[model samples]
Target: MILHRVAKENYNLLYSIGLTGYGVGMVLVPLFAEFLRQAYGWRGGLLIISALMANIIPVGMAIKFESHKNSRQRNGFQSVPSSPQGCNEGTESNSSTSQDTKGDSSDEIGVVRTIANSLRQSDFYMDPVFNVVFGVTFAYNMVWSGWHSFLVPHALQRGISVRNTIIITFAAAIGNTFSRVAAGFLTNSLVKPVTLFLFATILNIAAILCDVYFDNYYAMLVTTCISAMSIGGRSVLNQLVVRDRASPEKFDVAYAVDQLSVGFGLFLGGYLCGMIADHFSSYDATFKLLACIDVIVLLLIVLVRYRPKSNPA
Candidate 1:
């Protein structure tokens, strides 16, 4: 529980780090396609992805940083109440009893009740804001999966050279990394997520316009910049939403459940995007359609009247 203690400042720094890492990898995947095309040819693109699979090293390092003794110490201190001079030793026991009295049970129950009770007791999933966040994240992931699956192939078909495409991809990655770092700092400093979200929407709109109206290398590069901005912003915001929703006691489980959306989103996104790509005469049509979906979702997020709800578990 202490491990999840989030000062606004610390949250900013860590989220920035996460965004930077995600940007670097996302950027590399697209740019590296050129190398795969040149060194091994188009069909071997999947083989080049083994390099990303090797990214476990850096991920392991990040995990180690979070799990370090110094970090753990801070986390531990945050989880436990500070010692007070006049505190009773049995205070914790009494407090637990008091809480139990609110929803005290007489005896052990059946398996179904146990499971239901556990769900009822959890502080994560019982909120409307989290529900909307899940929806937004699901839409974002779907757009991403569809874009990546067909972006490069579509660009190549549209007279974009693999080398130039790679350059655009690299620039986007670099831009995304910097944006993430900036977002981290800003999140700590700012209170209004809506402002940041609005900015991201603008960027998303610009990127989609670039894709729809122009197919040149320069246009693609600019689109990549917009893509980075939108995605990097969304990534950090999602974490903040999850963090703000749960107390330290249930933070870990809440975060875990929130993160499950990513896996589900990616799986669903990939399958749907592939189907669209397979059926369309041109992948550009699919990209444009996805862009429209992004616009609609963005508008919904902007217009929605959502506030975080209480989870009294």
Candidate 2:
């Protein structure tokens, strides 16, 4: 249970480092798409983009997929009960990989088995910790997807110049990339991912409120940057939080489920954004709604964290 937290290499940091590439792509993709749209009409741009994307088929086929048996053998342990009491001695028989890097050495050797015993048996969603991760993922994706889609429109409505809107987008991309790298560098044993998630969500809501209640081009730029940084932290912590709770073997599956939640949130978020705005007759109504959701989701996570465990029957 503990090694998951104190892994020698710090997987979260590595993961955050990798995600910076995605942030870079965020800035680059728009420029590329715009260029394509201009160089060739929209239809031609789509066709070219489609042709370029088809390369993924060959790339996917070229990668050698690992067998499940090999994967289990490599991981060497399953993640069992997450009682915080640590894994039982019965699991002590499983010899885990020796963890050590130049300056790192964790005394705990029993990297407990995964959250789910096997691929077919995934009771992980029932775990309160996983549920907390789920809620955080869902709300973060829903609100952020809406932000990505509507922030430009919202800024234009506030009379921000198109040139300045582009600046805001650049600012956001910079903030997102910088924050992710910062999170990677800053996170350590004492820093908890859930705590980071909470603070990030708070920052996100605060920025949204600032942008909604007040209107100034500079203010929008600053708040958008703040929100982007908040999102960057959430993006980094998303994997870390789940990493803390899931064992090595189950990490792949747990992460897959987390991603599925993100997809669901994206769909629902766009829908809810439109629906709430139409229902409330205010374009900014959805920001307020998502802010409230942020509060509710935060409260639920707090409750889950503190809820007394039912005495094991």
Best by lDDT: 2
Candidate 2: Cα lDDT at 280: 77
- Point out where model 2 deviates above 4 Å: 1-8, 33-126, 188-190, 304-313
Error of 1 at 64 (Å): 9.7
Please give the CA lDDT of all the candidate structures.
0.69, 0.74
Off by over 4 Å in 1: 1-9, 25-110, 124-126, 303-305, 310-313
Tens-digit lDDT track of model 1 for 163-279: 887777677677778877877677677655545765776678678777768867777778877786777676776666556656655677767766787788778877876777778
Q: Note the residue pairs that clash in candidate 1.
A: none
lDDT of 1: 0.69
Candidate 2 lDDT, 1-313, residue by residue in tens: 2333235586667767778977798898778889999999889989998998899799767756457777667768565765666666555544333322422333222222342344334435335555667777887788778777778877777778899999999999999998898777667555777677777777888998998898788888999999899887778887677776665556667787889999998899889888887897665787787777777767755654464223324
TM-score of model 2 (CA atoms): 0.70
